[model samples]
Target: MIDSHEELGAELAEKVAAAGDLEALKASGAFDELMEQIDAGRLQIDGKDGFLNLMIKAVLERGLQTELSEHLGYEKGDPAARLLPNSRNGSYPKTVASTVGDVGLAIPRDRAGTFTPQLVPRGSRRTGGLDDMIISLYAGGMTIRDIEHHLESTIGTELSRETISKITDDVLEEVMAWQSRPLDPIYPILYLDAIVVKIRDGHQVKNKAAHIAVGVDLDGVKRVLGIWIQASEGAKFWAGVCAELANRGVKDVLIACCDGLTGFPEAIQATWANTTVQTCVVHLVRASMRFVAYGDRKKVAACLRNIYTAPTIEAALTAREEFAAGEWGQKYPAALKTWENAWERFIPFLAFPPALRKVIYTTNAIESLNYQLRKIIKNRGHFPNDQAAVKLLWLAICNIEDKRARERQKTRTTDKESSGNHLVEGAATAGWIQALGVLSITYPERLEPYLS
Candidate 1:
């Protein structure tokens, strides 16, 4: 609230005296000195009255560039100076308006520059701090008008709804590139699922599917490999998605667990023949429960638990037989029949060791990923189109993937030192047994290379 030149000078001296480093002192000196000089001449100004005015001017002239460049490691100049001529340039322009007592400044541009400074520049009549305010507003699920008023009341920056939209749209291009990036060659386990988002189609809001693929590398930590959008869950769309992963060098997946989507297994097999598609037993039980009567929900749920919680597949089959004999089963015969038909896919976890079984038995891994997606999408009620939906979903996914990647790298380093030899021996032994079994099957020709 210090407004007068003398008051600003006192604050500056106090700040510089308390500063821990030369750079901080320099930054504070520049900001405070500019404010003091600007405030000194303003008529009828008290310490509190003229502070915001002088501070805004100081921010424009030196504070914006200094802070932004320091943060981004960018020198004070054109943001696009280092880019090639043919490369696409990104522009983000903001309107900054501020007043000091009676003095005011508003900066506007012709909407031409390819670089939009996240930090506002000096002498810029446009409102500064709009970028951060806009992002915060967007994250908070505020409508455009609410954001404008919030900024107006909080920082006195006059931001229009159009300007806010323009600023938020800057994230779209970044989202696109991340969605199409290449993935790893081998994912030990892949978790797949879809989140539904509301999108505007021909003036009507409708639901669209956002498919996400997350992979657990050989080190056992999870990373999001890709995100995609589809009109609906179709074999052709999923096949293309699988093909895209293959083209990105995903040669094999040890286990691909997913909800029971038609043709999903075929789509995966087409991309990597050795990949084992394990249906999510949890999802199956939930789907089955939807058909059960309310009066028998508990009993039916108990019967279903026997299928999943049994010690082994053999035990699970025995439990399944008992469940079929129960009164709940007689009432919900179709539910039990459905499980019987799909029992093979439901029981694959029984063949693997407990460590692997823990991961592949349920779709909770992908379901948790979906939970994160929902958290992000809950703020965005409706997108403009399919592309817009994909873009936002990808941005959220990339943010998650980047964080997961760092943790996974650390986990791999630790695992390598602790259990490297054990992992190799186990993998080799499993490969040998699988190879022998394939040699006795009709696909011996396909198994020859691995056997050799």
Candidate 2:
């Protein structure tokens, strides 16, 4: 006779359920038994001692049987079953993806071909949120080997590093799908940056650049446009990136805030004729401070601030000219020249009001994102290849974007017209609403088509 763990578990579950409190259950040894079942559940992949895997499998199978009963129009042993047109038919074996690992299932069937499941569902490979959970853990800096051990200890299923890699590799498809998704026709602002990580290129570990593009929608919300991996950071690759953005529906970009990236402005102009390319003010200040003596850095930074914060572009230019003629500027000639060369790009944001200018004056928004990605990259140390690096970055991107989406869902948005202006409500009111007001006033002809 075969031993009945299921019957024993059911009896235990019933007694545990009837117990008055924790001490009562502990006195009956039910708690210890449950722990034993969990420890016993360990297996190479889908271990039997794993109470969670067993429970999940049981629920899904029971759900299938219940669905089968409904489809056949009779209970398992009802007299009506004998009279039914399409009675019970045996189940065929199937496997579904799960966090505990792949769950082997025997999905009950019917004589009729009409049984479509709702729990696991027909043609569905995974249930709910398991894949996201794996990606989240990986993004939070868990290596494949670490994640494998984590799943084994927490969920009682051991998966090979190859299996974990395959799971994360799936993110590449998602990243591609997201990259090709259509963009909003007009992005008021866009910030672009890159982070370099070491990846093995066949025989040698080489630096790989992960370029990230973030767009600020009209509502002032930040959206990560895409992540691209390349051998090096150069302007040449940007042309392709800009072209891809154009193809994906970015017809116009009002302002692009970036560091002193060569050839980037030309690449952007190639796509959107009227787009204004603005150098990151914060980056320029940092570069300036590097050249200043320690004693004068604060003063140099203050002078640079006065230039960017000046109410008018002409005033900002006047302040910059004064700074170039000052003692600190004379001492750090290269720093002044740096700003002078990029002044054409730096002055655009000055034309905006303080509320609007702050949003476009720097690439800090995207830099903040890079800070998060860099943390993940630092933990990984080095990846096996470009694909591995990209896969990890994409997973991190997914987790970050998911958190943003959840936050957006919790916030309310409003589009109210007041005195011939539109306000992007929700958190947008803080500055996005004001920035929209400025864009509408500043780019009337450009904003006209999109006004609803």
Candidate 3:
């Protein structure tokens, strides 16, 4: 086996080489010397012996001092120094203990002293009681009682429910700040939708709508723009939400895909006049399928698929008319009517390039976001209020944001193609603009500015 001095010298050499500049070299040398002293058993505490204990004590003391200085802005000679007063009159006491393996240095402390030691004791390397338990419990994802039992059994410490609640409650303010954060000015594509949750309003539990806005930005990375918990999902509420986004610097959105909620299209138009609203084709198909009999579901779905998958609007329309003339059409006129009513809005997607078509044709992107949200909220049967639901959903969205960031990074590393350029080409085409015009009449207020 290599001698201890050789190992220490190798470590010192590696650290010295890694040092960047003059100041870093000095710091590295100091740390290396400290390590050397401990390894040689040259440091002693109260007549106790070993190099390992002294190293641990030194590390703990330095860590506590750094935390206090950075977090509390405490400087040397400051009055706040008394809070974690030095053990040996501003010097650290070295107490040696047999239980501490390796380097032996025991730290001495005054029992009656006002200094509440934040570090591994003034001399001991054992961790503090409450703080360590709190960190462990949080890392384990244990509920309050489980955390309490864990601490009480493992460490023989009494942890109360109220204290645990207070600790977890700190996340509430963070959630609020995150929910209201500013968003980028232009998102090439946006997905908007709402998920319902049961929440207690006063004494009774009621359903509340949690509206979400997710977008693909200029860099092609998905981001959550904002989340709001409202009493209900309505045009008026969405109008206010749109206004809030505008105020927070969302200047433009090229296209917004959403479920067919009444007034949502109008709400989006009120904020961004040029924005195109793509009704969720999947939601439309599902709603239409609900009206068909079990035996007829497959046939009905086939006919609907024909309309959407057709190569052109003219071809889709011809197929729709032919299907309406068929026997199944006579039996399920309402399903056909649903498609007819939405046909004008639906066909505009065909005029765009395949890439743009894939994104605007459905609300599937937002649906995936909703699926993740449901997984998170599923365990909680109900919440205290709308704000509580909002907080949970916001936390869930933050989790998703991290996942999407990783996905975008990978996508950027692999794909270098641009999206949305063809969308402008389709926008300026006379035939495509005319096709959009037919649906505009049904949505006059929303389409007027774009038509002009």
Q: What is the C-alpha RMSD of each candidate to the true structure, in Å?
A: 10.6, 7.3, 10.8
> What is the C-alpha lDDT profile of model 1 across 14-52, one tens digit per residue?
454455457786666755564555567632233323445
> Candidate 1: TM-score?
0.68
Badly placed stretches (over 4 Å) of model 1 are 1-133, 136-146, 398-452
User: Which candidate number maximizes lDDT?
Assistant: 2
lDDT of 2 by residue, 289-363 (tens): 777789988878888888888999889888988988888778899889888888888888877788888788888
Assess every candidate by TM-score.
0.68, 0.79, 0.64
Error of 2 at 287 (Å): 2.3
Ranking of all candidate structures by their TM-score, best first: 2, 1, 3
Pitting candidate 1 against candidate 2, the one with the higher lDDT is 2
| Sequence-dependent TM-score of model 3 | 0.64
| Local distance difference test, candidate 3 | 0.63
Q: Please count the clashing residue pairs in each candidate, in the order shown.
A: 15, 3, 13
Query: Which segments of model 2 are wrong by more than 4 Å?
Result: 1-58, 70-73, 83-129, 413-430
Q: Model 2 misses residue 278 by how many Å?
A: 0.8
> What is the model-wide C-alpha lDDT for candidate 2?
0.76
lDDT of each: 0.62, 0.76, 0.63
